[model samples]
Target: MEQSDRAYQRALREQLARNELTFAHAPIGQAIVELDGTWRQVNGALLQMLEYDEVELLAMTFQDITHPEDLDLDLGLLQQTLAGEITSYQMEKRYFTRTGRTVWALLSVALVRGLDDEPLYFISQILDITSHKKQVQALQDFTAMLAHDLRTPASVIAGFAQLLSTGPYDDEVTSIARRIERASTTIVDLLENALTTESIDSGRLTARPTALDVRDAVGTAVQAALSAAEMNEQELEVDTSGLVPAVAWVDPVHLEQVMTNLIGNARKYGGPHVRVTTQVHDRRVEILVEDDGPGVPPRFVPQLFERYSRAQEARTGSQRGSGLGLYIVRDLLTANNGTIDYEKAALGGAGFRVSLPAA
Candidate 1:
């Protein structure tokens, strides 16, 4: 019995040593916190991440370094984990460093329990995401600059060109103004998409769904895109005989944005003829936009709606795009509790179907 006990003690000590070595050398921040939020142990990575020495961190609780606005959510989730409601929790949270700089981390935490199944302490792993967060902020700032610097000049140029096209200008001059108008309008639309992307990505835009006539939204989008279609010599048509006029429960602004993107996409990439139609399916409203151009290549269909995704044709074609339109459409539809799908059209081109809840 004495030999057996000695062997067991040696095995346990080896296990503990291995655990200590792993904890000390982890690449990311790792910490053990007491049940009452006091820092019981911390690794060197955590010390560097927080710009705090080991002694200072051990003397402080997580609450002391967490941002005030994020503290409540963190505490709530921690309480839930402690009460056996959750096994673990993960969140992107802000932490204030010892030097007073705010940093972002993807924090994952799990409770460590004793042999009797009682809570002993919390183990947390924090992966710093501060660099990624800064990159996203920079992109948003650039988009804002585009909206402010380019949109105003483009709109003014388009307005003057429109007047010259319809006013008492010579035919030759009128034709030049019409070309300028088309170019400027395209610029304005692209800028609008950039601004919308920034708003959506930053969570500043929200969908307010309501029961409204789908026809009005479709009409507005069709009218807004008609000029562009005409400039490309594409025919645009709409058919809504099968739709119930007041059944769609969607945000009106978002619905229009969706339609505009679809119609514009068909005009820019699809064949020379485009059609918009509506129907009812499974108590939902489906708006279908199709064109007679060559369909999307099969290989690119899977990522067609992803942000900044462009087909080879689009990249090499004369009509260049920012690759933001389809991504924005999908996001706006999702916000309104709607969905969009793509298929090969019977018209020998690309097809898009947007579905929304019925009121």
Candidate 2:
């Protein structure tokens, strides 16, 4: 019996030694904190992550190193975990390093308990994400700069091409100018989508919904799309027979953008004919853009409005798109308290239906 007891003790010691080694040398920052938030134990990775020595970190609470803006949320989650409301919690939060640099981290934490189920300490794992965050910020800044810087030149090119198209040019020159105009217009549209996406991501794009004439908005979009339609040799038509004036409660600018994107997409991807129709249903305004080209494949429909997602056919087709138009349309519609969806078009091709609330 004494030998058996000694063997059991030996096994327990081995288990504890392995656990201690794992805890001390894990790649990510790990810590054990008292219920009151004081640091009880911290690993070398935690010290390295915060640029603090073991003694320095041991003397400070988690709150001392967490970013002020993120402290409340962290504290709230900790409390919930302690109260047994949550078994564990994870979040992306910012921390202040010893050198006063702000860094981001993915933090996962759980509470420890005694045999009697009494709260003991909290264990936390923090994965440094500062580099990833910085990369994302850099990419966004570059995209914004590219979009803004290219807009003027693209617009100028489009304007010149339009003038050339009408300036007594021969058929060959006229055709080339029209092609230039189309390409420049496409660039401008892509830039606009990028800028709008940046605005939405930064919370700068907002909708001011008001009583709007759906037909007028649709008419404006149709007029703007006519040149592109003509270039594509596609017939475009609009039917506003049943749409009541001033029935849509939407931001006029947003509505116009949505319509333009829908019409533009049809011109690019649809068949030789496109039709836009509006109806009033249950006091809501519904706008449908339909094209006669081969409709979107069934499998691609689910991801149609996703940013940067394109159908395989589109990716291989003659027309190149940034794949941002439909995404922007959906976002703008959502901002204006509206919705859009895809369907089989009545014209035997792709269709998009936009619905807006009644004013």
Candidate 3:
């Protein structure tokens, strides 16, 4: 009877080992880790994700690929699972892939116990969710831009409607009508340009190139903006001193649109007048649009690029904007193989620098 029992125990041990290995080599990312955090068995999917071989992985611990910020939380949850305080846990964490990319994942882990009910190993299942996160961000950006774009003309129309009661006078009524027309024109232009976009949730804009002089486009946009600047009692300056008048292969209309938004934002949010400067560097042409108003708060800088996200400054007065201006400018710039960045203007305000590839 004792010999038969011994044989049964040996068979059970062999079966368990086979099952662990079978799980390790499965199609999805799975791993068996010791309670001490050392990886005991890693499946093929996990190995490919981390870009490590079976032999090399067994020598490392889970702490290795975990993002520094997420490490402590992971450890705490792991401790709870091992102590039987929790049966299992799931979390979103980042892992540094072998190629130096931060891989985002949804990780589920459970405690594996021995026959004596003592902690033995941990089982983990990881689902890659990086692409999902990006799509979510894009959708959020699209929604914000739409609100900003659609609201601008509506607000202008409302303002004009209020002024109509003060004007049975011919000139006054005509001026109001013209302003209303311009506001409606703005709305029509935006719709015409953007309404045909591919699904914002499923895709993004791409660039199309044509031969055009970006410098000439800047001059035209500046001329258009000068009227608004004058009305604001501000001086609009144009500096093409550094510009090389050459045609570039890009969508000239898009560049004009980018300038329109930037210059308009300057008039709305900046101090009197704005400066538009152009220059060429290496393979790219650059435009700098600056205003003398108070620059964005340091804390708000990161959020400034987010669509429809207004600054606290905008909340204080009529200086406020739809916040879609810069975001739309950025998206358009991206579609044209260009880039935009913010800086503190030497003139004691905010500055936006735009760069586009040269022909």
Instruction: Give each model's whole-structure lDDT.
Output: 0.87, 0.87, 0.75
The better-scoring model by TM-score among 1 and 3 is 1
Sorting all predicted structures by lDDT, with the top scorer first, yields 2, 1, 3
TM-score of 1: 0.78
**C-alpha lDDT of candidate 3 relative to the true structure:** 0.75
Q: Please give, for residues 72-108, the per-residue lDDT of candidate 3 as tens digits.
A: 9999999888778999999989999878888888999
**How many clashes would you count in candidate 1?**
1
Off by over 4 Å in 2: 55-60, 72-86, 112-120, 240-242, 280-284
Kindly report which residue stretches of model 3 are placed more than 4 angstroms away from their true locations once superposed.
Answer: 1-169, 178-204, 230-242
Q: Which parts of model 1 are misplaced by more than 4 Å?
A: 1-28, 34-37, 44-56, 68-90, 97-101, 108-123, 127-135, 235-244, 281-283
Kindly give the stretch of ten consecutive residues in candidate 2 with the minimal lDDT sum. Answer: 237-246
Backbone clashes, each candidate: 1, 1, 2
Task: Show the colliding residue pairs in model 2.
Answer: 271-293
RMSD (Å) per prediction? 4.2, 2.8, 12.9
